[model samples]
Target: MNITLKPTPEIILTGDRATGPLHLGHYVGSLKQRVFLQSQHEQTILVADMQGLTDNAHNPAKVSSNILNVVADYLAVGINTEQTTICLQSQLPALAELTMYYSNLVSIARLERNPTVKAEIQSKGFERAIPAGFLTYPISQAADITAFNATLIPVGDDQLPMLEQTNEIVRKINHLANKKVLNECRPLLSNAPRLPSTDGKNKMSKTMGNTINLGASEKEISAAVKAMYTDPNHLRVQDPGQVEGNIVFTYLDAFHSDKDYVEQLKSQYRRGGLGDGTTKKILEECLQSLLGPIRNKRAEYLNDKAQLMAILKQGSQAAKEKTEKTLFDVKAVFGLNIL
Candidate 1:
């Protein structure tokens, strides 16, 4: 009689698309959490170059160029390579294989019904001519999660549907296997609220020119803060200000160290004594201090591209071993493991 050992139950898998340099929104939403989680759990951070290509297939350079930038951003935010396995998605053949197998379990209509997918398709204006890859990337994401047996995935509220889809695949795989071949995962939702774009019109987006990158220079940071959206109704400093939608206070609430002080400012602004310039000045100072060291460290990492590539190569090797084992098990269950 043989008894198989279950994979570790606390592994975490998360990543970013290699589309652009990361921004404060990424830091608050997931990067900061990644830093803390690396030490507590077995974490794998994939630079998702393949997924980044779902929409950028016409411009592959957009994804290829930012692979190192994403990794540098990871290192800058204190994601120690020693603790977190940072691998390039395109380097992991097992993940692609797993994605191929998982794809059979999902259908086009099901993918179309995915709210996240629908929203993305509408936003990208891919309505009728949506790339097959873009429509099916959720299945690929499911493969990424299960390949490492990840049990905790860091995500924002908007991403819960993606995880729901992942677990749906998990259930199908396990049901087909007649045993626990895959582990169901949960979302480690961030406590931080979504950081709005500096313009206050949408979520922070790299394409919109509305975000302050993690690698932003001091001058750029100052300009972005100065241009932050504030209450249009408050034309005078003496007029009562609205704190609810003001981008300055929203940023302060997100980044400033002193919560009590931010609340005080909110109260003062509501009563008509505080000026938007004063709030923007303080927010700028807070952001400058927070991002200054990160910018320097990121530059240091990018300066050594050879070392960065080596790090990714080593991680991909380790990840290959793990994911290959999973692939073997899944295939064996499907009676397709003749190799």
Candidate 2:
């Protein structure tokens, strides 16, 4: 009997959709993990232009415009370019081919059943006109993961269903070929998964217009704070404020480092003394303290557009080489390659 050795698990694949500038929600949810994981793992950050276009097909220019913004966000948030390979998703032909191959292993019914897809379609109000590409993205995501043989995928808990779908496809291909050509990926959920929108939406998203941009100016931050939803019942400053649905306290809970102060404010608000203005003021300060440096770093990266694109192209080339080998092995298994 021959003993087979397993490669040490290190390859990590994680990224952002190139639709807009990353916001405070993204920074807290996923960006923080990318920063930490890059140091320990062979990480590849793909600015997912193809994924972005799945929904924004009509506005292709939005994806292109935001690619550099995503790059700047990644670099500014401390995803070291030297350590973490940053690339554009469209540059890799192998990923597209792999997606096609993997798509054959899945069914239309199963794709329709994906909870994440269903929830997203409902959220976007795309029930009547849902795009086929948008519905089948799990197959493409599986391609991205298996093509890189990614063992670690940093994501939120809500994305667990997508990983399950990916592993199912991997198992199907491996079982049919009688060989382990693909690896199943595991999700590393962020400690702070999301920051609720100041505008009282369940999630903070660009579409919701409820986000505080990572690179937002002082005026923008102040404006967002002013617009933050507070206690509707607390009409007067002296009236008791409920913290449960109040977006101001929600943000304060997440951003304000001073827990003792936050708890004190909570007590005052509950007892009917603290005003929304005071809470907003504190939240703005906390955000300014946190986001000020990130804006500066983003500006530095944005100022040198040529260098940013060059770095991304280099990473794309490296990614292309890796995915090529994986695709070659997969094609060979299926007798699709003449070799």
Q: Note each model's CA RMSD in angstroms.
A: 4.3, 4.1
Error of 2 at 274 (Å): 1.7
lDDT of 1 by residue, 1-339 (tens): 999875554799999999999999998888888888887789999999999999999999999999999899999989998899999899888888988988999999999999988998998899989999999999999999999999999888878988998999999989999999999999988999888999999767777789999999999999999989999898888889999989998889989999999999999999998899899999999999999999999999999999899999999999999999998988887899786
The Cα error of candidate 2 at residue 156, in Å, is 2.0
Worst lDDT run of 10 residues, candidate 1, spans 3-12
Q: 273 in model 2: Cα distance from truth in Å?
A: 2.3
lDDT of each: 0.92, 0.89
Error of 2 at 278 (Å): 1.2
Candidate 2 residue lDDT tens string, 181-276 = 888888877788367887886576777778899999999999999999998899888998899889888888887888999999999999998888
lDDT of 2 at 25: 86
- For residue 23, model 2's alpha carbon misses the true position, in angstroms, by 0.5
- Each candidate structure's TM-score, on Cα atoms with residue i matched to residue i, is 0.95, 0.93
Cα-based lDDT at residue 23, candidate 2: 92
